[model samples]
Target: MGKKISFVSSKNRGITLDMLVVKDFFRVNDEKVEFKDVVANENAKNSLVKKGNISIRKEYCKNNTDIICVDGSIAGKLSKNAPEGKRVLIATPYDYQFKAINEYDKGAFKKKNTYKNFTHIIVGSPFEKELLKKCYNTPKSEIIDQVCIPYSWRLNQEEFKKKHYDKYCKHYPMLKGKKILAILLTGELDEDEENPYAEVNWNKIFDNLDEDWIILTNSGKLLENMTHIGYQHRNQFVYSNRTFDTREVLSFADCLVTNSGLYATYFAVRQKPIYCLKYTNCEFEKYMKRKFSNLYIKNVEDIDMTKFSEFTSENEKFCEYFSYDCGENPSAKISEIFE
Candidate 1:
């Protein structure tokens, strides 16, 4: 019939965000996506791609692959080695630290030639499309703003509930009947910089928060909260001490309190009442504020329950401006591009 659709992930280590979107797209189509460990193909077993199945063998992506989807890093390598197939470069700039932004920008500029090999460049937001056009001089026609969400939140809602709801309920029994304020924090430090969380007085936030609120953080620094004296509502707070599966958490969360990071983009797309905290000043956060007016918190003390309505009213306009569609089926659109 037609050319077989295949994906070539750049990484041999583990699953990348690009692969997740691919998995979600196939899953939605009710089509089988078979995975092979290229490096260990002799002993590798063919596995179906689904939620939680994220391992990719580099050898699986060979010269015969028809469609190769990759992040910006592997664009050149795939171009030089496998020039026959159509390539899709997905841009996920928000998934990096402030310091890494410049490196990524410069790298994209250097790899302008690789842009020619790619059939299209899929970007998450219009902002990313603009960045590539301005910084790398990538052609506007080749860029498609998908305005999608992360795989964690994009999985089939029914499947996610069936597979994860019981597990979440087992671990977070206290979460029932509470208004969740999912606070996603990046606790890790840059190569040489100080901890960004240190700038925010987390202890103060915890002390002022009531029992009705459940604080779930993805940052490792929140472990200190486990033993903090102000952490009186032990059941109300959870840390990133282990793998934090946020599928159920986001579903249960009434509102989201997070920094002006990638997770904030997720909340914005969901149109959830979001309170964006700016712990450290960065160009990205400044850009977010300018684009999504009055969405930023001047101070942590300003976070009140009453602001949800005002925030919700602005979400529709904000998402529209960015071309982010919370209701859009990303997999359907992505599949059209590849198939």
Candidate 2:
């Protein structure tokens, strides 16, 4: 009999989606291999169900499974409990956030033996592999660098436009002739409740925009404030709640504006024009600025409205240095380990 693998993921959509991509690859190519999905939440379960008819479980079970493909952090916690003989595989895109770095600096992993159970660790890039080596003093032979990108990355601009443009235009008639400007906010509100974007000069930014653009925002709060009478371009903005898929909006967008995160990387890989906002001045923000030096703007007022056309032309150059290899077949590379 072939190896039986169980793919596990946390509740985070980014992690779950990447796990699904790897799972789909195995389903199509390795008919002899048996596998099951173990997701943390209902949302992840729904995503798996939407993909195809597959066996799923809420918790990880190692009884029949020869290999356990799970998230990085979760693998650490499972190490002590995992049976001695089973191979634990970690295929994750998590870019080692500030908290994890701090914990590593404090020698927390040494005390806990966090990654002791992992048989193979496959990360999205060399950057992530280096982080794992630095943090856990992991052996070079155990770690593999394979960039796991979103399945949507396979869709080119022409294909995406043909599939989604007409449907979106029908729903929002104003999107017909004008250029679509997608604004991606973190959607996190502060506890103070005064104003989340108090640092940004929103009024001056909106006033400088050309009238021919249709602004699409994911934040309802930002949308409400922008649509108020005080803003000059109130009529030009449209809001989509969490229920609406951001990828659909990104598919047809002419350009994107955001403070760095997973969505920003997605837009960058699509080779689209993106203007990055740097308000938080966090570590990740600094990393983004380093990657997109010409595209980073400290303040909203720093954006030059007239230069958007020029910016769009330089997207390929800007994204050439992007860390992840979205063009490579990560699933194929990962499957080779079993072969």
Q: Each candidate: RMSD to true structure?
A: 7.4, 6.7
* Per-model TM values vs. the true structure: 0.67, 0.69
- On the 0 to 100 scale, the lDDT of residue 73 in model 1 is 28
Q: Which candidate number would show the highest lDDT if scored against the true structure?
A: 2
Model 1 C-alpha lDDT per residue in residues 1-339, reported as the tens digit of each score? 334655544333234554666665676564555543222121224445321132333333435555545444233333246545555665554534222444454464332543444666766666566556555545433676654644423632556544564566567777666667766654345568654444455556656566677776666544443565354667776664355556345554567766645555555555667666665555455554555557777565465554543446576665444436645665555666765
The collision pairs in model 1 are 38-59, 38-60
Q: What does candidate 1 score on TM? A: 0.67
**Backbone clash total, candidate 1:** 2
Q: Against the true structure, candidate 2 has what lDDT? A: 0.57
lDDT: worst 10-residue window of model 1: 35-44
Candidate 2, 220-301: lDDT as tens digits: 5554455333446665777775645666676678788776455555565566677776654554456556655777776655
Which candidate number maximizes TM-score?
2
